[model samples]
Target: MVADDSKMWRTILKDLLSSEGYDVITAEDGLQAYFKIYESCVDVLISDVIMPGLNGYQLCRILKKDPHLKDMPVILLTGSADSVDRFWSMYSGADAYIEKTSSNALDNVKKILKNFKWKSDMPPQDGKNVFGAVLDELLAETTLRAEISELSNHVEDVDYTIQKIRNLLRSLFGIKAFAALMITMSEMILYSSLKDMKKTEEDLLSRLKRPYFPSYHTYRTIDGKEDVEGLNSIYKVISYDGKEEGVLALWRERSFSVREEKLLSIICEEIGGIFKNIIEVNEYRKNAYLDDLTGIANFRAIEGHLEKLWNSGKNFEISIIDIDHFKKVNDSYGHEVGNEVLAGLGKMLREFGEKHDVFVGRFGGEEFMAISEKSNFLTSVMNEFRQMVEKAHFSQSMPTLSISVSAGVARRDDFSSYTEVIEFADGLLYQAKKEGRNKVISYESIG
Candidate 1:
């Protein structure tokens, strides 16, 4: 029987356990659960804590004292992330504690049920030494994986590092499921050189679009042959608190063994928190390289984007645009209104970039930039924006006040690098401002 205040979770648990051939029962809360299971012959109890009336802990405590239900084997399902809850569950006389958000919740339930049945239903000397070895192996693997997980906390590029760890574990444990590997961090594909992966990347990407995935889900290919290809691939989602950070996919020609499934499930749990930390670190690094004011990507970001494009052999143009008489506006209208003008200009440039297929960023104060691939289109668009800013009103204080921008454009060349292209545009921009404001200067116009 499963008891919880959350009807959705209750349904989900009911479906999962019922699918495993167990006759399942669900209750809305602990109060309803007690009335149904009290003096009832139940083999196992699955309940959520923090429910109305008697909570799971209280229910477990009461049941433990009852002569008939004392050995029923209560399992407390909780959303708690802290280690303290395990102690509390044990104190309440619960046999097992399962976290609600656990990726392998159903699997954990099966393992718990198996152990309970093994101890209670089976007499001593039945399974004997073999059962003892199975239990010992499970415990040993759990403890070792926990230690490795703690060590992975220090890793930055978790996706890449985990490939090595997976290999090590495969060799150490003599694991058979090894075909191809694909690792991703929040839809950012880190490494995907998997066999038969030309279209597999698309498949893996589609999986990430889902709001959630079971910690371990199998994707079997049914290319109707003579026989069934069971569990051709495994997609392991690494997440924390319902937010996902990464996924590790493993492909194999043969079906997975039962032992490998258990091993991979434990590994997924261990790596989820580590990948979460890795993603957090990457976000922090990216944020540090962005401009605080004007919402412009910093020079470093621009360079990175350019480098990627250049490596891909794509044609692109770089332009530097500067607002005319910006310092005067700041001096006259105070920095506040000047800030409003800069913000307005950034928004305008961003819209134009989006509409015209350009990459826009604030190069610095009083200066902004746009990168585009269209040679004939972007130059005209930048010139048009210069004209628009000149005619548009910024504020009531400056109703009749005019704002103008001078731009210098440069196209990708065989001779010049991305930075060199920017420098060339910067020189032409100097020429535009020096000669006259509110004019667009092409590099062809200068030298």
Candidate 2:
């Protein structure tokens, strides 16, 4: 018996096994898989782990717990090469976890099915076709045995995962067009392989209207409903632990068969889990570059921004800002009040950064920094920031009490590297403080 949401895989496997003269059955999702397994005894169950109502793990657990079906060996299929996914398969009591992308997917299925071949005394005929090419040697078992940490090089962000799925479907199944919608830890991402690129989300969502799948139960009992005419596409909603994760919509000119439906479902489910892990990785990445108090980029992020500028060979004007007599403000009020001042300023700076298309972040203590593409008004931006700080009241303790900031502006042409620009800006900033408390100093004026 084979149970997967992908109709493509289901048809291929069923045909392969049937040709070998083995009676075969198929299911589209876990709900259908459960019924198909219980209806009549089968040799071994090959099921895809991620499914609509009941997932592979859920199905395996339920079967393992049931005394009647406990002896039935189960083989689980996954699309992700992630170790977290491997751990999940192991915990589910599956006899094997086959990665769909591995060249050995079909070979592994044969080996697993043979291991659990029922009480029959005779061996089932080898399912491989006489004309089919021989199975290639396992390539060091990468689809599973490879270290998951090595994924850092492969898994960049949700886009990497999204494009990977598109590539896999294209390479393996000849699926040329599909749309994926996912929301990861940092942002919402949308991708579609449709040629037009102009098709809106409304168009994709419209595809789901009119009717639910012709018959959801057709997946469970392969005998249920015949294929609907002109319906060559399939849509599967990916989720984890009862929460909505993402949706995949795909279409081909040919109508999907029972086998392909099961395979596609399993693929979508595996992608959901992969996306979840990616979200966690991205969150960690975002945290490492974020300031704890100011909610802006930290010094580490500043370095990255400078590296980007250097790589792009772009020139910019920069400003370094310092709060006037900040220590006195902290000493007079309290560190808590000082924090409030910084947070308020950070908020205002973030808005200013967006409005002016500049990079802004706290530079430790009461110092802040900004850099933008060269423009005559760069000086005005810096002075405007200083004036805004001077007029702002940070504390409720003394509503009328205000603070001021000093700034120094420098153009990138005056310096070769970020370190040089920063040094030049810092020198001018101190010169301003020395001359007077509230003042904006230009790099040219210092010389």
lDDT of 2: 0.69
lDDT for each of the candidates? 0.69, 0.69
Which tens-of-lDDT digit does each residue in 11-129 have in candidate 1? Answer: 98889888878778888977677666643445788999889977998778766654456788888989897888888899999988999788997789888877776222422232234
TM-score for each prediction? 0.44, 0.51
Could you tell me the lDDT of residue 69 within candidate 2?
Answer: 57
Residue 403 C-alpha lDDT in model 2: 88
Q: Determine the backbone clash count of candidate 1.
A: 0
Tens-digit lDDT track for model 2 on 1-447? 888899998998899778767789998987776665655455677888778987888778766754455667788887889998889888978878899999988877776666665542323322232102111212212332233233335556555656666766665456636676545323434476554332434454344323222110100111122233343677787676655555677666676776567566656656766666765675676699878777678889988898898779888777888888999888998898889888878878888887788899888899988988766556787888788778888777768768898888887775668789888888889989999868889866655
Kindly give the stretch of ten consecutive residues in candidate 2 with the minimal lDDT sum: 214-223
**In model 2, which runs have C-alpha deviations exceeding 4 angstroms?**
1-153, 157-265, 311-313, 375-377, 390-401, 414-417, 435-438, 444-447
Per-residue lDDT for 85 in model 1?
Answer: 82
* Residue runs of model 1 more than 4 Å from their true location after superposition: 1-286, 395-400, 444-447
